[model samples]
Target: MPDMPALHALTRSIDSLAPDIVTLSDRIWDFAELKFQEFRSADLLIGALRRNGFTVRQDIAGMKTAFIGEFGEGKPVIAFLGEYDALAGMSQEPDVDYPAEQTPGASGHGCGHNLLGCGSLLAAIALARHLAEHELPGTVRYYGCPGEEGGSGKTFMVRAGAFADVDAALTWHPAPFNGVRSTNNLAVLEYYYRFKGTAAHAANAAHLGRSALDAVELMNVGVNFLREHMPQDCRVHYAITDAGGRAANVVQARAEVLYLVRAPEMSQALALAERVNQVAQGAAMMTGTEVEIVFDTAATNLLPNLALETAIHANLVSLGPVPFDEADLDFARRIQATFTREAIRSSLRLYQIDGDVFSNEKIDGTIPLHLGLRDFEGRSHFRAGSTDVGDVSRVTPTAQCWAPTWAIGTNPHTWQVVAQGRSPGAHKAMIHAAKALATTGLDLITSPDLLSEVRAEWFEKIRQEPYVCPIPDHIQPDVGWG
Candidate 1:
């Protein structure tokens, strides 16, 4: 168990701050800002941090929405990573099972980032209070990271050396279950392949035309062929950003496609990227067109630290489970009715849970939420999805936990998640996560040997395979990229 005084202090602080925290999260959910354009959302978090006695710094790392709030002064600086950006075209009415958009085309918190950011802020505030009351020599910082959806906001922050001085970092995601993410996710690279060629009318100058659309088609075909020979773990996906024009009669003069490549390791991702580039070059040569490979953004694979995860897991065990009431369970069952049984099984598989246990509704009609904590036996789970958090883990000893903020089978970036964004259950889960993270923060701050063990694990891993920011220095966080 953690220190009694520190635990009580954190719990007390969270209780006092619970109402305001819930209000802030709901307001951010309303704002639903997207990517670097989260002006109102950033202002809201910044104002909250300042009001709570945290010294705030804005516009760091060349991104307007990116900022940090710090409290206390001294040796062990613990950071809580928070994100408030929402996904586009996901706007939905809260507490509704069916898809009803709040606005026709506006954004929504499909990934529960509103709960994510506010929960982290709550943890930071509670930890700061604990340090101040105990006269502890430590610093707590809340990182207001924007653009997590498709925009690698933390990756850019890492390149600017934002987290270089922090001893440890903690974060949490709003999910359907409570568990620590001890895993190595994929490293991803995104690029735009724009092709240029001479435009000519279809009937008048058939011989003079070099269709860029043809080049795009050829390149996609080439990439499809390359997929068979590449490593099974690597992935290559593309979308036709531009097909030149809607006029089928005209020979297209320009075309563009966005490609996202992912792999288990950065070296493998880079190598696969080169092979894809070669394929693009070959297509351009065959079509008599020039191709431009514009670098979009990238993030390195995760470097998991078992020591940091163990501390957070201990706190989760101590906290037992989120105090979800009957009303929460009723809402969850309603939301679960919208999705299929297979979706619940898929979600269980993602978390490495046995599908046969709770997936069948006949077996347990009351399995609305997986309220118990999962055991983290010092092993890394293999997560295929990528996140900018991977970049932060490469630099500092980073850890994150998932809280049950939605229904049991609800996946992220979907209408179902948006529907439950502002529910009472979501708010309770947010507070539950705050307690876990704050207690873990207290552990690192009060215990020197524990912090040293965490850092030792981090340093040893990076020493063998050094962390190189996958996003090049030349690429700035361009707000208009998306």
Candidate 2:
């Protein structure tokens, strides 16, 4: 393990604040606000940072929920990126194995971001306390990043120069396994295609009414056909946000659909987005309807730092496994029962774990809880999903870990995740992640050699291909709640 002065003090500080941190996480879970609207959730974290004696700033990048909290002065600044947003229509009763919503048609922490935000907060608090006690020269910052669910909150923050001065960044996610997130994820671009035409009676004026709904359908078809010609790694997904009208007797006057294009690189994603736009234009010409393309948001592809990942992996190995008791194990088993065999297999594949290791010798048996850390590979891998964190990575050296909070094979953005949001196992996972992050922060603050190595790697990568913010300058963050 890398040596640092008084590492125990940082871990002990986190342990002392365990109860309060868990309470904060549970409160956020209860609030369950959606993207760009996490007012109550942001307030709670901001209040905690202020009480800890850190200077706080709000409304970053013109975003109401985005903020930053800082402590200490000067170079070798380390930042902890925090997220506290929930998914739409995922409300569920806590501790329930089945799908039982606490509030119908409301938001819920289906991705366990309640734990994610609080864990990062606790890490920042512990690091700040250690720095103040030791009179350290470096600064510790907590970035209250909201709207990670399709909003690209961090991307806007990066464009606004939020992470320009930081030397290195650390973050962790609540996952089903404990390991370093040593992977390269895709970059993405999102847009809304709206078509307008004249509304008329379906039977009496079918020829006069150029149906906007037809244009929307044709656009989707053209994009589908274009898919076969694009790169295999690229992906395109869409959801019809507005389908003209419910009545079939009337020719629809307006229709809209949202498109998300993703690729291994930002340039590829941007080029593919233009192709998608051309398809939309073709559809508009075919149907004689006026089309409007509105930009939503965008995120860059992640650049992994092996030096930072190795340091974080050392801390995780030192922290050992999460202390899961019988009650926690029992709850995890019940949650695993709710998952299908295919889901379990898919999750196992994602984590690079064999199925036999998760099950006993019996034909039908329960999947055990993953209390121990997986073997660290210390290699760069690929993940199909995209994150706004990728934007931060482009600006500076960034590393993140995956701490096991849910049962094995419990996928995110599901009722299973919401059900276990407030469980004892999840709280333990949160604290474990905090300790790991804090210890890594200590190493970075004390060891200039390690920080230099991390930066050297980041510099070389960005030197080859300079980063350009995918979101254009003319577009502003969509502040509407809908």
Winning model by TM-score? 2
Whole-model Cα lDDT per candidate?
0.89, 0.90
lDDT of 2 at 473: 85
Which 10 consecutive positions of candidate 1 have the poorest summed lDDT? 354-363
Per-candidate count of clashing residue pairs (backbone under 3 Å): 0, 0
Tell me which residue pairs clash in candidate 2. none
- Per-model TM-score, in order, reads 0.96, 0.97
Per-residue lDDT, model 1, residue 173, is 95
As a whole number from 0 to 100, the lDDT of residue 135 in candidate 1 is 87
Worst lDDT run of 10 residues, candidate 2, spans 356-365
| Model 2, span 270-369: residue lDDT tens | 9999999999999999998999999999999999999999999898887778888998888888888877767776676688643244454111225446
- Across 1-482, the per-residue lDDT of candidate 1 in tens digits comes to 67767677788889899899899999999999999998998999899899989999989899999999999998899999999999989999999879998899989998999999999999999888878877889999999998988799999999999999999999999987787868888999998999998899889896899989999999999999999999988899999999999998888999999999999999999999999999999999999999999989998888998999999988888888889899998999888887777777677667754224455651233677766776676889888888999999989999999899988778889999999999999999999999999999999988999999999999999999898898888989869853
